[model samples]
Structure formats: C-alpha cells, structure tokens
Target: MKPLVAIVGRPNVGKSTFFNRMIGERVAIVEDMPGTTRDRLYGDTDWNGREFTLIDTGGLELGSGIPVGQVGLTGQPGDLMDHVMSQAQLAIEEADVIIFMVDARSGITAADDEVADLLRRSTKPVVVAANKADNAERRLDVVEFYGLGLGEPTDISSIQGTGTGDLLDRIVEALPPASEMEEEEDENIPRIAIVGRPNVGKSSLLNAVLGFKRSIVSNVPGTTRDAIDTEVEFGEQKIKLIDTAGIRRRGRIGVGVEKYSVLRSTRAIERCDVALLLIDASEGLAAQDTHIAGIIHEMGKGVIVIVNKWDIAQEQIRAEREGIYPDPDDEIQSAESYRKALMGALKFIPYAPIIFASAKTGYHIKSILETALKISDMRYLRVPTSRLNEVVQEAVRRHHPAAVTAMKPLRVYYATQTRVNPPTFVFFVNDPRSVHFSYERYLENRLREAFSFYGTGIRIFFRARSSKEER
Candidate 1:
C-alpha cells in the first residue's frame, strides 16, 4: 500500500525515460516512436528511505475523432490517441500525486496546455517536469511551462540524470504520510497465471473465461502491459486469475518498457500455483514457446498447455478438407498428428495436459477452469510415509542403481515424502553422490506411474545415510 505517483504527458515527452530514471531501471520502453507504450506500467522505488509505487502511463491525448497529422511542437504522431488517453486517465485516477511532464527541447505545445488544463480540474498535487534540459543553457526553456499554473517547472533531464534529485525530494514531500496508508491482508487463494508470447490470445482467453471484457482486448500486440489480477467464484471455490503482460523472447524485447513487462510476467509465474501456458495453434510451436514452458518446469509449478486460436486451425483444415484427406475419417488422424507434433516439441513437460481452445468462439474455454482446479489439487497431494516407501522400494526392485565401481554398488535404504505442493521426496542412500540424473529421472517416472500427479511437477532428492542411523 505504498503511495502512488503517476508520470503523465503527451507522446514521446521523455515520460518513460524519466520513469526509468526514477525507478533506477529500464522498466519502460523508450523509443522515438510515439504511442509505443499503450498501458500503464508500475514499479516501486524509495527516495531517502521513503517508498512509493510509481506508474508510467501512455501519452494523454483528448478528442473523440480520429487524430489527424502531427502536433506542431513535438511533431509526434497521434494515431491510437484515444486508447492512449484512456490508459493515461486510468493511471491518473489511481495515483495520489501526478507528475506532468513536458518536452524541454521542443518547448510546450497545445497538447501540453490541454493536459495542464485537465490536471487543474482534477484536484491532485501536480508537479510540472520539463525534461531533456541536459544543462543550464536549456534551463530557460522551463520558464514557458510556468504558464500552465502548476507552479515553476522542474528543470531535469531523464537521460542525463540532471536535476532529478530535487524532483524526487519534491515528490516524496507530496506523498501521503505512512500512517494514512492501509495494509492489505494476505488471502489464501489459488492464483492462475495466464502466460505466453505477444498476440497468443492470453488476454482473449481470460475474457472468454470471465464471459466479460475484464481486460482491454485489441489486435495490437502487447496491449495488456501490467499484470492485472481478478478474483472470481467458480462454484464454491474462489480463484484468483492473474492476467500478465505478454512475454517476448529476450532478444526481441524492446528497450525500457517491454523488458520490464517480461520481468512482471516472470514474477507472476513465481507467485502462481498453476500456469496456463498458451501457444498459437496456427503458428504451431516456436522456440520461444518452448522457452516459456521451460520456465514453468524450472519453477516447479503445475501447468496446462493451451493451444489457442484452434478455430483458425480448424478452418484451415476445412478449407483444404478434400485436398488434404480423401476420406472424411482421416480428419481424426490429421488431428492426432497435430497433437503428436506438440507432444514431441514439449517433451520436457509431458505431465501437462493439452487443451485445444478458441477464445474467439468459446470452444473448450470452460474446461480450462475445471482443469486448473484439478491440477491445483494434485499439486498439494500428499502421500503417507508407508505408501511412499513402498513405491520407492518397488521402483528400486524393478531397476537397481548402477555401481559406482565394480566393488561398490549404489543402495537406497529408505524413502519418505518430505513435502507436498510439488510432492518432494527424500531417499536415504548409502552414497548420495553415486546417484546419476538419469536414475533420478527414472525414479520420478516411477513415482508418476504409481500415483496420479497429473498436472504437477515432482521433486526427488538423495541423501547419504550411515548404517548406524539406519539400524
């Protein structure tokens, strides 16, 4: 519950650059391109031990009609101005204080005046920041912003990090006192993280499941910038659904903002009990898709693979129905071929259940909630000590561990369930170092076969135990 401070300005006014400077990280995408950032991006930072949450918002532009041409002062494009304005307005509503940024190099323009007037009626503490004033020579440019009536503009450079310390001090002074902030109680609920690359229908799937427009959906890739959490009741169970920003490959992630989005998505995975890993059905599996699935495996979280946009794939098959398959019965064979290819590509997480869905048409969408609940229950399944040891003993009898040398052979004395929620087990062995990865994997497979761990990952550990302790 830290105090909220939002950075607001027109397109390409160095708002994101200033945001990155304040947060001390490149969290926002900073390109010369206007409207690159379409959603509000948030981060937390402390100034002189006082902490606050900062929101970097898209450029605010008003008017209902399609914005034509470019602004005279900044010469920045205004396409998608309405959406960007909506994003900014939402940020402003959630913020405790507002930092209105203007371009120092280009000087104030008509757009700046419009934003200034908007802030005047809002009744919030507003700070005017004239950015790109790298040196004392451009300090005179900030004088023009004084006309906005928000007081003298703070001369600073987001890129060079000049005059920002004073701006931080001013912002901290304007924030609400610590006593006024309220603390939120922790809730024990199942959190499902919807994760995938951009344009993979992750947001669409969420909207489909919710049966309403809970999140803003657009054809634009990366439309959802922040990790938005929504709580819903499914029968008697209350579940938390976290809709995260689309994660792009590390190399393709643009400078500043999009990079921070990937970080948020990764954090969501760490917090969730189960993850819905979505892949484009028409495009099939890409290397990045595999990369995302690997992350879920490495995190030891339960997962469900969703092949989204299945309707598109279905249509493609129908169009070439006669050409691809002479017999109508062969459609089943063609479908199996598609599923088999996905299995081969994602062999690492063979435990995950795959569902072919179309968010656009609501095909197989309802099953996702039921499937996630089942997987979550499996993740927390605990096995009794006696049963666990019996499984381990049977596994050992089937295939003995290889000997370290001709004279010394590996021996497992006993095993016990150490924990649940990923179902960890510890095996007491004569020599822990003698156990190899292949043998460990084999034991995991044996455990999976004996028990229905369905959609969750399992962990197995080996520990050396002396004969005296065993006796």
Candidate 2:
C-alpha cells in the first residue's frame, strides 16, 4: 500500500487548492465558501517516482460541536461541523502522515490549536504547512505556527504552487520506505462498490445482501459518510464489498462534509472491479443517477443497475383491488415502463443488466450476487486468437469499411485479443486512421454477437500494419 497523506485544516484554509496542486488537476471542487468540503477526498500524486495517496479532508472545528443554522455559501443552513470532524478523524486514523494546513493570514487560532492537540495524540508523523504565504511579507506569518509544536512550518501558496516541492520532500522523508510500505496482495478477490445518492437505500441494500447489519442503515440522509469495506465469502468465492456515501449533484453538494462524501464515493468507484449502482425505485430515474452511471462507465467497470425499493414501487401501482396481490399484467406494465425510462436515461451503458429488488422484503436480493458473478466472469473472459480473427473477418466481410477519401476503402489485416478484464482487442489494419467510430462500434457488436461479453465493457484498438509486416 502507498503511504496515505491526509491534508487537514480549518474551513477555507486552501486544503482543496493544495490537493488540486499536488494532483496536477482540479479534482476537488474549490470555492470561496467556508466548509465547502465535507468528506475525505482522495487523490494520487508522485514526486521523484515516490507515489502516495493524498486525502483532502473537511475543515476541522474545535469547540463548536456542530454548525447549526449558520448560513453557508449556498444560503443553506450549515450543520456539517460534526460530520466534518468525524470524517477528519477517520482520515487521521487511516493516514500514515498528516499535512496540517493553517491559514498564514489568520495567524494561530483556537481551531488550529485544537487540531494540533488532536494530532499530537496520534503516533503518525505530522507536517505543518502555512498556506497562503504567497509573498515575502506573508512568508513571515509561518513563525506564528511554530507554537503548535509539530515542527518548523513549511511556507507555501496552494494557488501559486510555491514551496510545494519542499513540502513534498518533507512528506517523502517522513514516510516509510517503499519496500516496507508494500501491503499483502488481494488482487484475486473481486471488489464491488455499492454507490448511489443519499437515502437511496445503499446501506440497506448492503445489509440485505450480506444478510446482516454490516453498515449503519438509517432513514436519515448522509448516514454513512465514509467508504466502509467488508470482505465476505459467498458460494466459495471471497469478494470485497465497499459501501460508499451518497453522491448528490454538484449543485446540491452542500459545502463541507458532503463534498468529501462525493469524492470518497468516486474513489470507491475507481478502486472497484465491479460497481452495483443502486437507484431508488420509488424516486425513479433522476439526473444524479444518470451522472453516477456515467462515472461507472467512464471507469470501465462491470456494472449492475439495481433498482431498490421495489416493494414501495409496487405499492404505487394502481391495480384491481381484488386481493392483496396485484394483477400480473399491471406488474409487467410497470416493470416495462421503468425499464424503458431507465434505458432511455442510461443509453450509454446499455450493456449494464438491470435487476429490481427490495431490501425490505428480501425480494430478488440474491440475484445480485448471481449477476455480479456473471459480470465478473465476463470481465475476465478471453477470446482465442483464432476465434477473434474469425469473428473480425466475418464482420468485415458483412459490411466493408467506407472509403476515408474517395476510393481508398479501409482494410482489416488481422485482429488479436490484447487483454481481458474489460477485454481489449487490437486490430492490425491497412490504415488505423481510416477506422471510423461507427465502424469500431460495428466491429464491437459483431464480436459481442460471437462472444457473450455481457455486463462487461470492451475496447477495440486499431493499429496500422506496415507493408513489410504484411509481406
């Protein structure tokens, strides 16, 4: 395992800015508002070939237990202090080194002092960063943090990217050597991340699937703020399950802990081999659901669309009141309507298989495991080279590629399976540039027809075969 470096500081102290700088991309949403980040956001960075995982945590508050009725940047009530503190504490627990950031302009405050006190209790190495030290005048502000008793504070500007190299040097020195940091391998186990918006029955689905209360399930939104991982054995297969926080739309992502929740949920998606994207059946398809599905697709993970709260959806169907059961046709009609709406919204992920389940009544919950296993198998499925070339030849013969210019028709020389786990195939052709997107889709459809790669993503790569190689 790479060393975990966590950035912790007060609200609006430029933790997100620092994270974005280190990662060389604007991942964490940065805003002028205080408490803009809520959960533990993670990113990976390497300097001088020394790679480490960085976590951006919400601002730490000291005395005030919670932010009650305080207006935030979005004009909503700020009640995330407790959640922020909890998430920060969790980050600290998981971190190998802590980068405690402080505002250079504000000088030392009670919150910084409190956070310093909290860090001193942990055995993890702590590095103090005095951010916003953009100029010579502001650089002198680093002296104020010397009283925190961690060490000489590193002065830097997150926005301007100054002094970050020295800070990273300090972190690499404080971290354990890479040889000692390597963790035992568990790559064979299939990891699944359960993700969705808040109060969408994510935790309930987890509990029902595991047949126990592995995760905290409550009616309240944002109950599970951290990505909790559990390993279980079912049908002689050991699989890792990650239950993540609900992901809301960017506009609805309230400043503070909730933002971190979204980041962690995204990280979970990145780490998983398969993602069980849960949607609320009662709520139907929403924009956020579509966005979440896009994330899974972008990650190229095997996915299963789980429609939770099927019991509640059945209650809404207006069927003949002859008995407690509904008419079979009504159920079929409702299912078809839902399938159409979902298929339309998630046309990009047409390969994802859908299952309607109810965690409350254990309805079709076991099928999730069955489908997930099939998807996992499909992800690792490899097609023989002879069989792959045969399929490609047949596809090309059926519909010749349209000419790129006027009379120069594209030619497929040969094809081979390059890799598996979202199986990738490489095709050696006359001119790789002439392979249009539609032609690529046509080839993919033909390959899928010949091979059952259901519930798994596949990639087709076109490479130019030189004349000498053709000879």
Candidate 3:
C-alpha cells in the first residue's frame, strides 16, 4: 500500500479529467455532466522519486452522502447522488493528503466554498488546484481560489497538460514522509480481477469472498464505476482482488461511463495474475461473455470461469420442475446440462476451472479463493529444462507435425522454459513455420497434461537454432 492522495471538488470541475491526465490514462469517466464519477477510482504514480496512490472521487456537494452511520456500499441501495457522496466521503477518509480541484473558468463559487469549508475541518494537508486554466487570464483568475484559505491554488489545464509539474511537486510535499508509508508489498501479492458483463454478480462475488459488503452492490448496471482494488489475506497468502466495472459490448458502450469501464476492465485483466470471469447463471452465457473470455485468452492471462447467481437459476428450474412457471414456451434445463454447454462454449480455454456459485447464498464461495490460489501458483510454476524437453519429445513421438512437401518432418532440436506467470516456453526447431497452429496447441496441451498446469494459459514459440547453438 502506498500513501493515499485523493482529489476532491464540486461537480464537473474536471476532477475526473484531471485524474485521467495525471494518471496518463482515462481510467475515470469524463463527461460534461456533474456527478459522472460515482465511485472511488484509484491509480498509482511516482513523482520526485516518491510513489503514491491517487483516488479520483465524485464531486462534493451539500448534504452529499448518507449520514456517517449509514453507508451506500455493500448491498444497501441509494439514490445516485447518495452513492456519489458516499464514495467521495470514503475517498476523503482514506487520504493522506487531499487535492482540492476548483474550476478556474467558473471562478470560485458557492460549491467550491462548501468543499473548502469541509476540508478546513480536516487535519490532513490540502492543496488547492484550479483546473481548466487554459490562458493567461484564466491562470491569473486562479488566485481567487486562495480565498478558500487552504493554501495558494495552483493553476493547471487538465486537458492541455500545463502547470501540472508544480501540482505534482506540491502534492509530494504534502504526502507523509517516506518512512511512514506502507511497505512495498504490491509486487508480491497475486491480483485476481473479477470481470464480466454488467449485473453478472462480479461485485457480489467479491463481497462474498471477503465476507463483507465493501463494494457498492445494486441491481443497476454500471453501478461500480472504477476498478476497485481491495487487499485481503487467505491464510498466509495475501491477494489483491479488483472488482472491475462491467466490460460491455463494443457497440452498446456509450461514449461516456461505459466506454471508460471497458477500458479499465481490460486494463485490470492486463495487470492481474489471474481473472475470475463471472457469468450470470440466470443468463447462462452471452456472446459478450465469450468476447471477454477471448480478451483474457489473447492477453495470455490465467482465468477461472465462475457461473455466478446459481441460486436464482436453480430456483427457476425448481419452479419449472414443479410446473409452477407461467410461461410454457420457456424450457428449464438441468444444472449439469447448463454446465456442459457453458464449458463447451469456451473451448479456447478448456483448462480453465469452472465453478457454479451463488454469491448471494455463499455457495461454493470458499472454493473460489482456494482455487484462485492454486491457479495463481501455476502461473509461476517453472518446469525444469530437462523435464520440458522430455515432454516435448514424448508429445512429438505420439503425434508429429505433418511433413512439408517432400521436406523432412520438423525437428525439435531443444526446448527451454523462458518465463512464468503465463508460463512461456521456447523451442529451437529446424523451421519455425513447420510448427503449425494445431501442433503448437498440441504441445501446450501436452505440457499441461504432464505438469497439471491448471487454470493458466501457457505460451510456446519455435525458433531456428543459431550456428553455434546447433553444435
């Protein structure tokens, strides 16, 4: 865990925009509308040789969130504004330093004053940032924010990328000294991102795994805006779980929040050591589900297919079995058949472990963490060089590559384990092209069969041997 720094402001003050600019990606949704950001978005960056985590929060307004006793998170539902304020309040409570973003173009307003008044009561250091300062006049107008009495305001253009260096320097100065920060244990923890279509029980599964309702859970789609990272311990092993916003289909994704979600979800996959691809049990598997699976495959990520909301699907089936369902046209299938069909649809990742779970009921919830740890171990499993070549030789003996027009069959000269975490293997061969796609897949399968490389995708590459190596 790094020192937490939060960005706070009124609606449409370019808080999300400035957050995106600072993190060097559009992780937060940037719209002209107020209250666009409803959850805490987090990113890590280093400035002046110091690394810290930045939190992008929804705008602060009057009576923003629920009272301190009542929170909108977990299973409790709230109005959109209530959720926004609740998220912003959480960001404020977790920050080691707060960056107060005000609008330079709009000048200091009542909303800014309201936010300033709130921060003034906090003991944490506050740095005022006047965003949207595009020109000399706008920059000069930034001085008006000084009336907030927090500190001298820094003029910055979140879009144009100006005057941000000074902002970073100021933020660094406000951060607690290096000695007080949490130890750098991020690299050692295995990150597993729970990803899938909207309302597929991704957040529910997260809450179940942690035995608490930490993430915002609602029936509404796109409820979880940011890729929320939560760290938990499974016995002695510490793991980071990222409950990412839904990865909606490309065509249906709007140019606003949904678009930002898809990007962050994909980024979550790229960063994680393993992914839990949650499928709605009631919905079975949708085309969008496979699309997300394809992404996990292409990224060479370790994956586990979780059929969530199994309780709902089972109850519906029971009703149909009792002839209680009203709609005669709808046929109910057995859970076994559903599992087979779902597994069959994901042939590309046949090695992935599948579990039917009800996040609401805590059914098979314990297995998820245990299975994730087992799979994460495979990602780092390095086979001995000797054992790798032996498996290759046996695989080739059983089924060799087809001969190329009058040419000798492809010779497998040697092989070596190149890397782990999506274990990659390199083989020196007579001709790289001779190892066809099917043959490559066969070798991967054989490796898995020999070593039980469960729940992780493995890579194999054939390379021609150099002259000296040929000797």
- Tell me how many clashing residue pairs each candidate has: 4, 8, 0
Tens digit per residue, CA lDDT, model 2, 1-471: 567798887788899999988998988778876755644457789988899989886544322423222435345543454544564566677678999999998898776777787787878899999999999999986898989998899999999999999999999999988988864538678888999989989899889888899999999999998899999887898888999999988767654556567777987887787899999998998889999999888777899999999888888654335346766787888888899889888988888899999988889878998888888878888888998888889888899999877435789989998888778999998888788888988888888789987887787889988879989
> lDDT of each model, Cα atoms only?
0.81, 0.82, 0.81
Arranged by lDDT with the best first, the candidates are: 2, 3, 1
In model 1, which residue pairs have backbone atoms overlapping below 3 Å? 28-256, 28-257, 29-256, 29-257
**Residue-level lDDT for 186 in candidate 1:** 40
> What lDDT does model 3 reach?
0.81
**Which model scores highest in lDDT?**
2
TM per model?
0.62, 0.80, 0.61
lDDT of 3 by residue, 214-244 (tens): 9999999999988999999989999999999
Candidates in descending TM-score order: 2, 1, 3
Model 3 error, position 407 (Å): 7.2
Residue pairs clashing in model 2 are 1-183, 35-256, 36-256, 37-256, 38-256, 38-257, 39-257, 39-260
lDDT of 2: 0.82
